[model samples]
Target: MSTLFPALALTLFTPLFGGLVLGLVRPMRLAGWLNLAFCALSFGASLLLARDLLAAPGGVYTGHGLHIDAFNLPLIVLTSFVGLTTAIFSRRYMLEMYAHGRVTPLRMQVYHAMFQGFLLTMLVALGTDNLGILWVAVEGATLATVLLVSLYRTPESVEAAWKYFILCGVGIALALFGTVLVYFAAQQAIGDPEQGLTWSVLHAHADGMSAPVMAIAFVFLLVGYGTKVGLAPMHFWLPDAHSEGPTPVSAMLSGLLLNIALYAVVRFKMLADSALGQSATPQLAGHLMMGLGLLSFLVAALSLQRQRDIKRMFSYSSVEHMGLATFAFGIGGPLATFAALLHLLVHSLTKSAVFVTVGHAAHIAGSQRIERIRGLIRTQPAVGWALLLGVAAIAGFPPFGIFASEFLMLNATLQSWPWLAGLLLIGLAIAFAGLFRNLQPMVYGSAPEGQVAVRANLWPVVVHLLLVAWLGLAIPPLLAGWLQQATRLIAGGGF
Candidate 1:
C-alpha cells in the first residue's frame, strides 16, 4: 500500500534520471541501453500505480498540487507503455541508422536523452493536479519533441520542427491563458487564489463558478489544445512534422503525444461541464468539435488521394482518426464518451504498430516516396504484412478495436444527429478507399531495384497488434470496468 506513492514518483522521475545519465555518458551504446531500461522501469511503475488506482478507485492521492484520479491513471499507464515500446523499437532502428552513417554516435545520444525527456514531460502533464502546471508540462513536451523532430538536421526536418514549435507554442500559450481564466472563475468559489487553480478544488466547486468566464476559458482551451489534437484548420503542421521526422518519432507523435493533448482537453471539458452545467458547455463544444472533425475528415480524405510520401499519407490518416475521436467526445453522451475513450486506446495502439512497420519498410526500400517503394511483400514479408494488417485495422476493418469503437460512436451520433452520422460514414468510406489504394501497390507490387532486407523489430509491433485484437475480440472485464469508470467520471457521475 505504501509503495504506490513511490511507484508514482518513480514513473515520473525515472525518465528524467535516465536522460541525465545518458547526457553524462560518453558511449552512445550505453546511453541507448540505459534509456531502454529506464523506460521499461517507468512502464512497470506505471502498471503498479494503475493497479493501485483500480484497487482503491475512490481514494484520492494528493501531493502539493498533484492529484491522481481514475481519469488520468489509465492514461499514464498507456503513455508509459507506448514510451517503453518505442524505446525498444528505437534501439535497433537507431543502430541501423548509425550503421548507414545517417546518424553519428553523438546525435544518437542526444536522441536517447530527448526521448526520455519527452516521456517525462508527458507524465508530468498527466499527473499534475494544477491546471497551470499541466499547461507548462505540455509546453515542455512540445519543446522536447521539437528537438526530436529535427534530429536529422535536414532542411525539411528543420522546417517541420520550426513549424511545429511555432504553432504549438502559440497554442500552448493560449492554453495557459485559459488556465488563468479558469483560476479566475474558481477564485470566487474556492476563496484562495493558489488553490483555485488546482483541479480538485476547481472541480469540487465547479457548480458555483461563473458560467460566462468558464465559457470564455473553454474557447481558449479548445483552440489551444485542439491544435495539439490535430483538429482541422489547426492541423496544418501535423502532416509535415510526421512526414519529415523519423518514423519512430512519428509513431510516438501520433500514437501517444496527441492523445495526451486530447486528454488535457477532455479534462478541461469535464471542468467546463461541471462549471457551466453539462448541457451548457458540452453542447457548444460538441457542435464545434463535430464541425471541425467533419472538416478534417473530409479534407484529409481528399488529401490522402494526392499524397506522394507514404508517411504523409499515414499522417493524414492520423488526422482523420483524430477527428473521429474528437467527434465522439464532442457528442458528449455516456455511450459516445465511452466510445471516444475506446477509440483513443485503439487508435494509439494500432497507429504505433503501423508506424513501426512503416519505419522498417522505409528502411528497406530506402525511400519514403509511395510510388518508389513497391513490392514490400517481396522485399520484406514481415514488415509488408505488418503494414498491410496495420493499415486494415486503422481503416476500420471489422474485428479490430477501432471498428468496434467507431460503430458505437456512429450509433450514438445517429440517435442524436443523423446528418452528422451520414457525413461521418461518407468521410470514412472515402478515406478508406484512398488509403487502401496506396497500400495495395506497397504491399503486393513488383519489388523495385536496390531494395535491401533489413532486420525488423517485430516485438513492439506484435505486442500492440495483439492488444488491439484482444481488446476488440474480448475486452478483459477489469479493463472494461476501468473504462466504464473513466467514462462515468467524464459523464459527471462520481462512481
Candidate 2:
C-alpha cells in the first residue's frame, strides 16, 4: 500500500501543475496538447492505483489527507477517464469556437486552466480522508466550474454561472455545518479535535457517537450535497448551467461533478449509518434518501418532456439518473449497491458521449434548440449515430449498460420495497418516453434553413458507447470483481 504513494501523488498533483502551467501559456494549440498530456498522465496514475488496489489489503492512507479504498477508487478512475476523453473532444470543439471567433486566445488559456483546476479539485475531494479538506475541495471545484460555465461570456452564460455559484455556494455552506456537527459528535467520544475530524477515526468510533447528532448531521449533509447532486427542489441551476456552458463543461457537470458531490454524500452517509447502526435513525436517513431520490427522479423525468433546449433535455436526464443511483445506494444491500455502482459508471460514460455528439450536432445545426436542429442522420452520420447510440443506452434499451443496472436495481428493490420498485419502474418509463419524444424529430427530419454540418472528432464518442455496450452485454471479470468489492465495502461500511 505504501508503494502506491507516488502514483497517488501523481494522480493528485498533475492537474494542479497543469492548471498553473496552462494559465501562463500563450499558445492555444500548445495549451490543448498540454491538457491532454496531463489528463493522460492522471489516467495512467489512476490505473496504477487500481492495480495496487487489486494487490493490497483493505483501504490505505498516506497519512489522513489522501486515501484510497474500493468505494472511492472507481470514481477516481471514472473521473480520470472522462477527463481524458473530454480533453480529446474539446480540442476540436474549442478550435471550432476559435474559428467562429467566439473565443479569443486569452479565453482559450483560461478555459484550459480552469478545466485542469476543475479536475484537480475533484481528485482532491475524492482522495481526501478529512471532512474539512473534502469540503474545501468541493467548493474549489464549484468555483472553477463557475468560471468554465461563464467562459462564453454571453448573457445567458453569465446568468447560468451565477446561478451555479450561488446555489452550490449555499449547498457547500450547509455541508460545512454538517461536517462540524459530525466532528462535534466525534469530539464527545474521542475528545480530540484533530482525531475527531478524521474519516477513519470517525468511522471506527461511529457506533459510540451520538445517534441523534448523526441523524441531524446526515440531514444537513444529504440536503447540502443533494443540492450539488442536482436533486429536485434544489436543481434549478443544473439545466441552465448545462445549456449555457461549453458542451465540454456541460459533459463534466453532468458526468463528473455531480458524481463527485454524491461521492461526498456517500462518505457522510456511511459515517452516519455506522454511527446509528440498527437504530431507526439510520433507517430514517435511508428513507430520506429514497424519498428525495424518488422525488428527483419523477420530477426530472416529467420535466424532460418540456425542454426546448437539447442540452437542457439531457441535463434533466442526468438529474433522473443521479436520483436513481442515490435510491439504489439508499437501499443499502450488496445487490443494490452493485447496481448503483454500475449505474454511476454507465451514466458517466454514456452522458458524456451524448454531450460530445451534441457538441458536434449543435455545431452542425448552428443551434442547440431541439426544434431548430434537424436531419442529423442525413447531414452528419457520425454525430447522428453517436447520439442515437448514446440515447439508446441512456433510455435503458436492452443490451445496453443502463438496462443491466436498472434491472439489477429493480430486482433488488422488489425484495425489500416492492412499492418503491414499482415507482422506479414508472420513473424510468417516463424518462424514456420524454427522451424518445424529442429524439425522433432531431435525428430523422430535414435540416432547418441555413444550417450546415461540420466534421467532428467522433473517436471519444465511439469508444465510450462501445464500452457501455460491452458492459451491458458482459461485464469483464476484473471490472465485475472491482465493483463487487466496492459494493461490499459500501454495504458493510454503511450498516
Candidate 3:
C-alpha cells in the first residue's frame, strides 16, 4: 500500500468504525469521551495527510479512486479539525444534557454514533473523485444530520427534521438530474462510456463539452447545491433546522456542512465555467452565483435583525457569511477566490466557537431567547465574555480572521467592479450592525435573576478563538501558500 493509504484509511474510516462501535456499546454515564478520542485521531490523520500532500510533488494524492489536491486538502483539514473541537465541546454539553434529563442514555449513544457517521459522510464527499459518489456522500450527510436534528424527539424538533428532509430531498433529486446531465455532456464530449463522471476526467475535457448543455446543467447545479448552501429563496429550511437541532449539530451545520455544500457549488461552478470557456456562455454561471449570493447576503443580513432565538440568529449569520464567500468565488480571480477560501477557514472556526458560546449561554440563561437572556457580564462572566468574544470575532471585528478575508475581498472587488464593491460594503455594514444591535442588549442588558451556568468546558472555545485570532493577526506563510495555490487552481486551472 502507498504511504498515503494508511493515513487516508485512518482519516476516512475511523469515524465510521467508531460510530459502529459507539452505537453498539452501552452508554456508560455517556461515552462522549469516546467520540472526542475518535475525532482527535481523525484530525491527526488528516493533518498528516495534508502535510504529506504538501510535501509531495504537484501537491497531489491520486490513485485509489481518491483525488486530494491543494483545493481539498485545506477543506479536509478544516473539517477534521472542526470535528475534533466540536467533539470536545459536545463531551461537556451532552454530558450536561444527560445529567439534566434532557437526553437519555440511548439518545446519547445515537448522538455519538450519528455524529461520527456525519463526519464520515463529509469526508466521503470531500475525498471522492466521482460526481456520483459526491452526490451519494452529500445525500448520506443529509440522512445522518436529520437523525441528529431530531435526536430530542420534541414535536418541534421532529417538524424541523421533516422540513429539512423534504427540502433537501427535492434539492438532492435536482442535483442527481444535474449530475446525469453532466455525464451526458461528458459522454458526448469524451466518447467514453466507461470513464463515467469522474471529476478529473470531466475537468480535463470540460472545454469540449457542449456549451448549451453545460450551461443548463450548471443552472440546475447552482440551484440544487445552492439550496443546501442556504442561499436565499432556497434557505427557508436552514433556520428551523439550526434552531431545532442540538447546538453541536448547529455548529457542524454552520462550520462544516454548509461549507461542504458550498464547496460542491464551487466545484460545479468551476466545471461550468471551464466547460463553457470563451463561448456565448461568457460569465453566465458566474453571474448566476453572484446574483444568488448577493440576494442571500442582503436578505440574511436584514433577517438577522428579527431573530429572537440565538441559534436562529447565528444561523442567519451563517447564511450571510456563506453568501459573502459565494459572492467572492463568483467574482473569480486570485485575490477574490483566495479570500473566499480563507473565509471558509475563518468563518468555520469562528462561527463554531460562537455556537459553543451560544450553547453555553442558552443553558446558562435557561432559554435560547435573547429577551430572556440578559447580563451575561453579570450572570455568567465566563460564558458571557466568551460569547462576546465569539460574537465580535464573527461580526468581522478588527484583528480577526474574517476581517482580513473581507478586506481582501473588498480590495479585489474595487479593482474590478467598483459598483458591486459598493453593494458588498453596504451588505457587510448592514450585517455588522444587525449582529451588534441584537448582541449588545443581550450582552450588556440587565441581568435576569435565578439563572446560572455550570463551570463550562471553555477549552474548545479558547482554542478555536485563539486560532482564528492567530489567522487574523497573520496567516502563516505555509497556509497562505496553500490558500493561494488553491485560489490559482480555481481561477487559472489545475496547478
Candidate 4:
C-alpha cells in the first residue's frame, strides 16, 4: 500500500518523460526500443499500483488531486498493458513501413513522440480527480492522435485527421460547457469554487444539487463524451480515422481511447443518478444512454457489411462493442454494470489483437483493401491464424471472453427489458456475418501473385487472445472481486 504514490507518479510521468527523450533521439532503432522501454516502465508501475490497491483498506488511493479506486484501477492497468503491447507490435511494423519509404524520418520521430504523449494524456485522464483536468486530458489525447493519424500525410489520412479534429473538438467543447454547468451546480451546493471542480467533492454532494441542472448537464456531457465513444450519429469520423491512420494508432484508438471517454460518461451518470434519484425522471440519463447505445450498435453492425477496407470494417466492430457496453451501463444493475466492465476489458484486448493482425495482413498484401488481401494462411500461418482467432473472439464466439460478456449482458437485458433482446441478437448475428464475410476470403482464398510473409510479431496477439480465453473459461477470483467492487460503486449494490 505504501507503494501507491510513487507507482502512480511513475505510471503517469514515464511516458511524458519518454516522449521528450524520444523526440530528440535520432536513431530509429533506439527510438523504437526506447518507446517500448517507456511503456514497460509505465506498465510495471501500473501493476504496482494495482497490487497496492488490492492490498489497501478500501481498494483506493487519493492524493494531489488524483484518485484511484476499483472503478479506475483496472482501467489504468489495462491501458498501460495495451500501450506496452502495442509498442511491441509497432516497432517492427513501423520499421517495415520506414523501410518501404512510407514514413519519413522526421514523421517517424513525431509518431514516436505523439505515441508517448497520447499515452500520458490517457493516464492523466484516468488518474485525475478533477473533471476539468479530465476534460483537458481527453482533449490533449485528441490532439496527439490527430498528429498520429496524419503522420502519413496522404490526402485520405489528412482528411480523416481533420474530420476527427473537427468533430471531437466540437464534442469536447460541449463537454467543457457541461463541466462548467457541473461546477456551477457544485458551487451552488458546496460553495467552494476550487473543490467544486473536484469529482470526488461533486460526487459527495451530488444529491444536494438541483435535479434540473444536473439533468441538463448530463445531456451535454453524454453527447460530448458519447461522441468520443463513437456512439451513433457521432460516429462518422471513427471509421475514416481508423482506416487511414497507422494500424498501431488504430489499435490505440479502438482499444483504449473509446473506453476512457466512456469512463467520463459513466462518472457523470453517477452524479446525475444521485442528483435525480428523487426527481420526476430518475432514469433520464439511463434512457438516453440506452437509446444512443442501441442506435449505434445496430447502425455499426449493419454498416460493417458495406466496408471495403479491412481496418475500416473492424473499426465499425469497435463502435458496435462500445455501443453494446453503453447499453449495458444504461441498464444500470449489478449484473449489467459488471457485464459492461468485463465487455470493456475483453473488447479492448481482443480488438487490439485484431488490429495488430490486420497490420501484418496489410503488410503481406501491400494494401489494406479486403479484395487485395488473400490466402493469408498460405503466406503467413502465424498472422492468418491470429487474425482468424482474434476476429472469432471479437465476434463473440464460444469460449471467448467477448462471448461470455455478451451472454451476461443478454441475460441482463432479458431480465430488465426482454423486448430489446431480439434487436441485440439481430445486431450480433449481422456483425458476425459481416466480419467473416470479409475475413474468410482474406484468410482462405487464393493468394495473389507475389504475396509473401512479413516479419510479424505475433506474441501480443497470443497474449491477448489467451487472456480473453482465460476470462471466458473462468474469471480469476481476484479480478472478479475487483469487478464486483466496481459494480457496487456503480450500481449501489454488489452481487
Candidate 5:
C-alpha cells in the first residue's frame, strides 16, 4: 500500500473515532482534552500526508475512494490545521462558557462530539473523489453544525439553527439535483455508474458529456453550493448563525465551511469548463460565477455598515471576502486562481483569529453588541491588539496575506475585465470602512465601569497572525511551488 493510504486514513478516522468516543464521555473537561488531542493527531497526520505527497512523483495520491492532488493537498492540510487551532482555542473558551452557566454539562458533551464530527465531515468532503460522497459529507457537516449552533438552546440560537438547517437543507437538495445531473451526463459519456460518479473519471470525460446539461447543472451547483459559500441573496442564515452560535462555531463557519463549499463549486467548474469549452458560449459557467461573486461582494460590503452586533459584522466580512475569492476564481487564469487560493488560506487564518479575539472581547464586555463592547485595550491588551491586527489583516492592510492576495486579484481583474476592477476597489474600500468604524471604538473607546479582563488563549491568534504576516511578506518557496502546482491543476497552467 502507498504511504499515502495510512496517513489519509489516520487523518480522517482519528476524528471519526474521537467524535464517537466524545459522544459518550460525560466529563466535560476530559472531553475537551480529548477533542484537542484528536484534532492534534489529525493535523499531524495531514502534515505527514502533505510530506508524502510532496515526495511522491506528480504530487498525486489515490486509493479507497479518495483522491489527493496538488489542488486539495494544501486545503486538506489547511482544514486540519485550522480545526486543531480552533480546538485549542475552544478548550479554554468553552470551559469559560461552562463556568459562566452559559453551557450545561450535557450541552458541552454534545458540543465536543459535534465539533469532532464537524471536522470529520470537512475532512471527508475535501478528501473524497466521488461527487456523491462529497454531497453526503457536506450534508453531514450541516447536521453537525446545526447541533453546534443550537448548543446554547436559547430561543435565538434554536431559531438560528433551524434557519441554517432549512436554508442549507434546501440548498443541499438543489446540489443533489446538480450532482444527479452530473452523474446523468457522466453515464451518457462513460456508461458505468461507479466510474461515472467518480470526479476524476467525469473530468477525464467531461468534453464528451452534454454541454447543455452541464450548463444547467452548473447553475444549480453554483446556487446550491454558493448558498453555503454565503454568497449574496442566499446569505440570510449566515449572520444569524454567526451571532447565535458559540464563537468557535462562528470561526469554523466563516473560516472553513465557506471554503469547502467554494471548493465544491470549483471542482464542478473544472468539469463545466471542459464540457463547455467547445460550446457556443464557452465561458458560460465562468460568466455565471463572475456575476454571482461580484453581486455577493458588493452586497456584503454595503451590508457591513449596518450591522450592530460585532459577530454579525465580521460574518458579513466573511461574505465579502469569500465573494472576492470567488470572483478571482471566476476570472480563469493563473494569476487569478493563484490569488484565489492564497485568499482562501489567509482569510481562513485571519477570520478564525479574529473570531477567537472577538470571543474574548465579548467575554470581557459581557456582551456581543458593538456599542457595549468598548475599550478592549484597557480591559485586555492582548485581546485588543490581536483584534486590531486581525481586523487589519482581514481588511486587506499591507504586510498581511489578504492584501497580497487582493492585490493580485485586482491585477487579474484589470487584465481580464477592466470594468469590474472599479467595483472590486469600491467594495474593498466600503468593507474596510465598515469594519474599522465598529472596530475602532471597540478597541480604543472607554471601558464600562467594573469591566475586567478574562482568561484568553491568545496562542492560536498569535500563530495564525504570524503565518498570515509571513505569507504576505514572502510566500515560502515550498508553499509557493505547491500553490503554483495547484494553480496549474485548476487553471491549466502555472504563473
Candidate 6:
C-alpha cells in the first residue's frame, strides 16, 4: 500500500483529475456538478490538512520530497477554500450566462475544466518544496488564467488576455533567470547543482552562499514576482484582465492567486535574509517594498475615484491591498509578518466575497459600469448588503479583520519607523476616501431600469464575509499560534 498524507496529494491533484473529467464529459450540467463535487472534496481535504497542521505540536509535516509547515499549510487551506466557494458560485453564475445565450454548453465545460486546472496550479505552487517547481507552477497558473480570462472571446477580453500573457510571460522569464542565479549561489555553498533549488536544502546552506549573487537574485525575483503580485509600474495588466474576465476568474485572481505569488516572494525573502544576514536584506528589501507600496497605494486610491466600471474599481483595490501586504512583509518583524499573514487571509476572503456580490449585482443590473448602476439596496438587497459590508471590511473599517491587521502593521511600523507609519496612515486615509466616494453612488442612489432579480448564490459570500468578520473580533488561539510559528520561522528560527 502506498502510504502518504492524503491532504497533500488530494489538494494538489484532485483538481487536475476533475478538470480532465469535466473536459471529457458531454453535458454542461454534469460538468458543473462534477466541478462542485471535486471542489468540495478538495475543500474537505484542505480542512483535514489544516487540522493536521494544527495538531502537530511542532507544526511540521514532512513526507517524501514535500514539506508542509505552518507557512504553506494555511495557504493551501485558503487556496482550496476559495476554489470551493468559487466553484459553488460558478454553478449559478455560468448557468445564467448560458441562459443569456452568451456561452454554449461545450464552452461551459471548457470553463469548468479550466477552472479546476487553475486550482491545480495554485495548489501546486503553494505545496511544492522546490523553488523552481514553485515558479513553474505560478507560470502554469498564468497560462491557465489567460485562457479563463479570454473565455468570452470578446475583443476586449482577448486584448486583456494578451496583455496578461505578455506581462506574465516576461515576468516568468525574469524569475527563471533569478532562479538560475540562486541555484548558482547555492551550488557554490552546497557543491550540488541538483539540490540547489530545493527550498529546504537552500535554506540550510543560505548563510554560506555568496552574498552578492544572492542580492542580485533577490532583485530579479522581486521585480519578476512583483509583477504577479500586482505592485505598481508592473500592474498595468491587472485592471483590464479583471474587468473583462469572468467574474469568478476575477475573484480568484484577486483572492487566491495574488497571495500565492506573494508567498513565493516571501519565501525568497526568507532565503535572502538567511543568505545576506537579516539586517542587510530586511532593510534593503523593506525600503524598496515600502516605496512600491506607497506608490501603489496612492495611485490606486486616486484611480478608484475615476473608475467607471465597478469591477475595475475593485481591481485597483486589489493592487492597493497587495501593496499593503508587501509592505507588511517588507517591515520584516514578528508583528508585521504575523499581520501580513492575517492581512492575506482577510483580504482573500473579503475580496472574493465582494466579487461574488459584484457578479450578482452585474447580472441583475445588466451592466458593469458604475455610473449606469445605482441603488443596489432597492434592487437586490442581498448583493447590495454584501457589497456594502465587503467594501467596509476591505476598507479597514472597525471590527473587521483588515482593520486589525492594518492596525498591527501600523503599530509595528511606528515602533521602528514612525515616519513610514505616518505615510502609511495617509495612504490608508486616501484609500478610504476613494472607496467610499465610489461606493455611495453605487449602493444608495436611485435604482436604474432593466434591473432584474438574480438567483444569486449568497452562501459563499456570506460564509467568506462571516469568517473575515469573525477574525476581526477574535482569532482562534490555535490559528494565532500557527501564525506566530510561521512568523518566527520567517524571522530567523529554522522550521
- For model 3, the stretches where C-alpha displacement exceeds 4 angstroms are 493-495
Question: Tens-digit lDDT track for model 4 on 3-69?
Answer: 8899999999999999999999888999999999999999999999899878888887778999899
Q: What is the TM-score of each candidate against the true structure?
A: 0.97, 0.97, 0.98, 0.99, 0.99, 0.97
lDDT of 4: 0.95
Worst 10 residues of 2 by lDDT: 57-66
Give the CA lDDT, 0 to 100, for residue 240 in model 1. 89
| Residue-by-residue lDDT tens digits, candidate 1, 110-185 | 8888888889999999999988888988999898889889988999999999999999989888988998898888
Cα lDDT tens digits, model 3, 183-274, are 99998878777666888878888888888888888888888888899999999999999988999999999899999999888888888998
Off by over 4 Å in 5: none
Compared with the true structure, what per-residue lDDT tens digits does model 6 show for residues 250-343? 9999999999989999999888877777445446656677677668777787777788898999999999999988988887888888888999
Error of 6 at 2 (Å): 12
Model 1 lDDT-worst window of ten? 278-287
Ranking by lDDT: 4, 5, 2, 3, 6, 1
What tens digits encode model 5's per-residue C-alpha lDDT throughout 268-287? 99999999999998888888
Total clashing pairs for each candidate = 0, 0, 0, 0, 0, 0
TM-score of 4: 0.99
lDDT of 2 by residue, 108-138 (tens): 9999999999999999999998888999999
* Candidate 4 ranges with C-alpha deviation above 4 Å: none
Q: Assess candidate 5 and give its TM-score to the true structure.
A: 0.99
The model with the greater lDDT, 3 or 4, is 4
Residue 450, candidate 6: Cα error in Å is 4.8
Candidate 2's clash total is: 0
If both were scored by lDDT, which would come out higher, candidate 3 or candidate 6?
A: 3
